[model samples]
Target: MKGIVLENKILNDKYGIICIKSDEFAQNAAPGQFLMIRPQPYDYIYDPLLRRPLGICDINEKKGTFSLLYMIVGKGTKLLSKIKKKTELSFSEPLGTGFNLTTDKKVAIIGGGVGIAPMTFLSKILHENNEVDVFYGGAEEKDILLTHIFEEYSNNLIIATEDGSIGHKGFITEVFENSLKFNNYDKIFACGPKPMLKAVYDIIDIEKIEFEVSLEERMACGIGACLGCIISTIGTDPNSNSQKRCCVEGPVFNGKEIIWETVCKE
Candidate 1:
C-alpha cells in the first residue's frame, strides 16, 4: 500500500456521498480499475482492518492526482467520510484489468449505481477514437451522480431512475435496448449489478452484439495473493470446470465467455 494525503473533499450529500481528490497514484491508473485503500493512523477501536476497495473515479495526470467517489455504506466507509483534507491514506492502486477499447468503433456504455465510477474513465479513453453513448441507472435522482463528467465523452447520454425523479422511469437496460435499435454500435461495455448484466447478456445473446462486462466480487487481497475472489469459467476441458480469479484474471471479461447462468444463480 502507498501512503498519500487528500488534497480536497467534495461532499455530494449527507448520506456520506464524497468525492475525494488525492495525489496517490493517479498517473498509473487506468479506466475501469480501482484502488484498495486503508485509512492511515488506523483506528483499531473504530476501523479494525484496512480500507475497502474504491474505484478510480477520475485522474488528472498533469497534476498527478486521482479521485474516488464513494457512499459511506459501512463502518470503513463511515470513517473515510470523516476524514478531512490533508489526512493521509494508504492505497494499492491500478488494480484489475480495465475495459478493452476497439479502434474506430462506436460503443454503448452502460453503468448502474456506483459502477458509474470506472465508466467515466472508460469514456475518457474511448472519446479519443470511438464514439460513446452512455446509459446510466440509479434508484433515484440523488443516487445518480457524476453526470457532467460522462457528458464530456458521451455522444448521447441517457438516464433512468426507478422513482422517475429524473430521466426515464425505468431501468438503464431499457434505455440501452432502445439505443440499440436506432444506433449501429460495434460493441457494448457495462459495469453494474449482476442482475443488470445478466439482463444485458440475455439481450445480446440473441442479438449477437459484441459485449464486455466488469464484475464485482468481494475481495480479500487486491492482488492475486489470496484466492478469495475466484470465479468459475468455461474453458478448455469441458468435463472439468476451471476457475478464474477476478482479482487477477479479470474484473473485466468477454460477455459470452462468462458462465452467466451460474454467476447469476449465485
Candidate 2:
C-alpha cells in the first residue's frame, strides 16, 4: 500500500516519529504488526534496496493515520528521518501476527528503547478493557519518549534508565522482577532487547501467568518467501527445533514455546 506522510516529528537527534495517512492501515493495523517501509530520496533509485521493518507505534483510525516511531540507527532510518511531509511512500500491508488482545484482566507490559514503539499501540488497545502496568527502560531520561502516551493508557507506569536519570536507576527488568514478587498479573507481554526479553522470560513463572514476547529480527522481505528472518523454536517432535519466519509467523509468540537457548545464541 502507498501512504502520504502527514507529519514527521523529530524528538531528538537520534529519534523521530513519522505519521502517514493510510485509511487501510489505520483501519486494519493491529498491535505488534509491522510495516516494511522503503526509504529513498527518489522513487527511481533503489540505493538502499531493502525496505526496513518498523512496528506500528500509534494509529488513529478515525483520522486515517498511523505513525512509525524509529531511531536513526542506520542508513535507511537516516533517510527515513529526512523524508518530508506529503511525500508518498510505499508500505507493505500490515505484516506478521499481532499480540492477542485480552480483556478484563491485569497485565504487565515491558518495553525498552525502540521496542517501546509497538507496546504503545498495544497498551492503548488493552487499556480500554484491561488494567495495564507498563515498564519502560532506556539509556537515559531522554530516551524515554513515550511516557506521556503510555501514561494515558496504563494503570501504572514505571521508567528506568541506566544512568539513574529516571524513575529507576537500573534496568527495567529488575523493576519488573521486583513487581512480580508483590503483584500477581494475569499476563505479561514484552518487546525489547534480547537480553531484556531473556531476563523477563527467566523471571516469570510460566505455569502461573501467561506470557507473550515480541521478537525483533532483521528481515530482507516482509513475507514468508524470504528465509532471512527465521528463528528457532521447540519442534513438535521435541528432538529438534522448528524454524519460524519472524515476518510471517510472528513478531509475537508465546514466551513459553520459545527456545531460550537458541534465541540467546542468535
Candidate 3:
C-alpha cells in the first residue's frame, strides 16, 4: 500500500460524510474504478486486512489530485472519518476495470445512493466525447449529493426520490421509463441497489438496449487474491457453469452477459 496524506476534507453530514483529496496517485485512477483505503492511525485496530474500497469520485489532473467521497458506515469508515487533514492514509488504488465508453453514442448513466459516486466520474469522461444523460435516485433530498457535478456533464439530468422531495415523486426507474419515450439512447450504464439494477435489466432486456452495470458486492482482497467476492455468470463454454469473482474479473460487466436470475436467486 502507498501512504499519502489527506490534503483536504469536507464534512457533509451527521453520518460522517466527507471528501478526501489525495496525492497525484489518484490521478492515475479511471472513472468507475476505486481505491482501498485504511486509516494510518488505526493500523493496530484494523490492519493486515483489506480496507474499505472507495470509488474515485473526482479527479483534478492539472492539480495532480483526486477525491473520494464516502459515508461512515462501519468502524473502519468511522475511524477514517475522524482523520484530520494532513494525516497520512495507506491505500492500494486505481483498482478494477472501468466502464466501457463507445464514442459517438448516446449514453444514459443511472445511479442510486452511494452508487452515484462512480457515475459522476463516468459522466465527466463520457461528456468529452458522447451525448450523456444522468438519472440519480435517493430516498429523500438529503440522500442526494453531488447533483451539481452531474448536471455540468449531462445533457439531461433526472432526479427521483421516494418522498417527492426532489425531481420526481417516484423511483428513478419511473424517470428512466418516461425519458425513454422522448430520447433514444444507444447504451445504458447503471449502479445502485440490487433491486434497482434488476429492474433496469428487465427494462433494457425488453427494449433491446445495450448496457453495462457496476455491481456492489462484499469484497476482501480487492485485487482478487481472495475468493471473497464471487458472482455467478453465464459462460459460453459448453462444459462449464458457475460463479466468477467480482473483484478480479469485474466490478463492471456487460449487462446482458450477467446471469440475472442466478444473481437474484442468491
State the lDDT of candidate 1 residue by residue for 28-74, as single tens digits: 77787877877444545444475577777788777677777776677
Error of 1 at 243 (Å): 0.9
lDDT of 3 by residue, 1-266 (tens): 45444453544553333344455565677877877777444667645356787777788776556777776677667676677766667777688888887788998999988888789888998999999989999888876888788879989888999998988998998889878888888999998887888888877653578888888787877898888877777787856556777765678877777878777777
Model 3: runs farther than 4 Å from truth? Answer: 1-11, 14-24, 40-42, 47-49, 238-240
Please identify which of the two predictions, 2 or 3, would achieve the higher lDDT against the true structure: 2
2 or 3, greater by TM-score:
2
In candidate 2, stretches whose alpha carbon ends up further than 4 angstroms from where it belongs are none
For every model shown, the clashing-pair count is 0, 0, 0
Candidate 1, number of clashes: 0
- TM-score quality measure for candidate 1: 0.91
Runs of candidate 1 exceeding 4 Å displacement = 1-3, 7-24, 43-46, 205-207
TM-score of each: 0.91, 0.98, 0.90
